[model samples]
Target: MRDIMGMMGKVKEMQAKMEKMQEEIAALEVEGKSGGGLVTVVMTGKGELKSVKIDPALFKDDDVEILEDLLVAAHKDAKDKVEAVAAEKTKAMTAGLPIPPGFKLPF
Candidate 1:
């Protein structure tokens, strides 16, 4: 009985922590650059694209394909960063729990 109560308490505590962690993740922002800094992407942890920046030099009429490629690369980089940060936060939040290896939290 005591263990059950304790476990419930922990569950509630974890729930509260998760709520706060989610808020923190939602507010997180990261930047990614590509093409030797010719393009950059800014994205939120929730994977929403906030903005993009491309160097004026990349605005060539003949190099539209290159610019498009750089934009894609930059977006991918930012997405990876966002995932990394989210994983890190999830790990920290679940520290000391009995979660199994490779078990992902539902963000």
Candidate 2:
């Protein structure tokens, strides 16, 4: 049927758009910092950690636990930012879709 063909075409178009969006998200980066900017982490929108930075002042033998905590916090902050970016991109991609409430996309 003509209607079915048209619907299929739209679905294909949406799939292509989603693929492009995912590529863009994969190329995006976000940065997060903690401990008054003493610790920082960079991550991609796909949640891959790109890098981490630490202030040289934190380099000492007595504060290993504190340094570890700061690193954890910075990594968490970066992950949160990455998730936010992915969610925003997904919202834009699925803006008009009829997906049910509380239905999360399997990314």
Candidate 3:
């Protein structure tokens, strides 16, 4: 049962590390831009939208649809960045662990 006990200890340690990582991720902010920086979005690592910025010049344009599209693109960019950051941090946190390759944590 020693092996099992050791494994359990490792699991507990990993859990703590994961919790800390989650908090770190929640505190991170990433910025994304679109339409040659005319539209920008800020999002937390958890993919929550934090804020949006639009160039004043875009207001001079009459096509609202284009502005809408740019906003969507910018939000998507921010979301992608957030995912990238999460992946990076997770990789760091999992380094040297016994987890099988391609296995995801936190179920």
lDDT per residue as tens, model 3, 1-107 = 99999999998998998899899988889999999999999998878888999999988868899999999999999988877888888999888867798777662
* Pairs that collide, model 1: none
Q: Is candidate 2 or candidate 3 better by TM-score?
A: 2
How many residue pairs clash (N, CA or C atoms closer than 3 angstroms) in each of the candidate models, in the order given?
A: 0, 0, 0
Instruction: Evaluate residue 63 in candidate 3 and report its C-alpha lDDT on the 0 to 100 scale.
Output: 82
Candidate 1 CA-lDDT value: 0.91
Please state the error at residue 49 of candidate 1 in Å. Answer: 0.5
1 or 3, which is superior by lDDT?
1
Candidate 2's residue-wise lDDT over 55-76, tens digit each? 9999866789999899899989
**Over the stretch 1-107, how does candidate 1's per-residue lDDT look in tens digits?**
99999999999999999999898888989999999999999999888999999899876677888998999999999999888888899999898888999999887
| Candidate 3: regions farther than 4 A off | 98-102
Give the Cα error of residue 71 in candidate 2, in Å: 1.0
The 10-residue segment with the lowest total lDDT in model 1: 57-66
**Residue pair clashes in candidate 2:** none
Candidate 2 to native Cα RMSD, angstroms: 1.4
Instruction: Name the Cα RMSD for model 3.
Output: 1.7
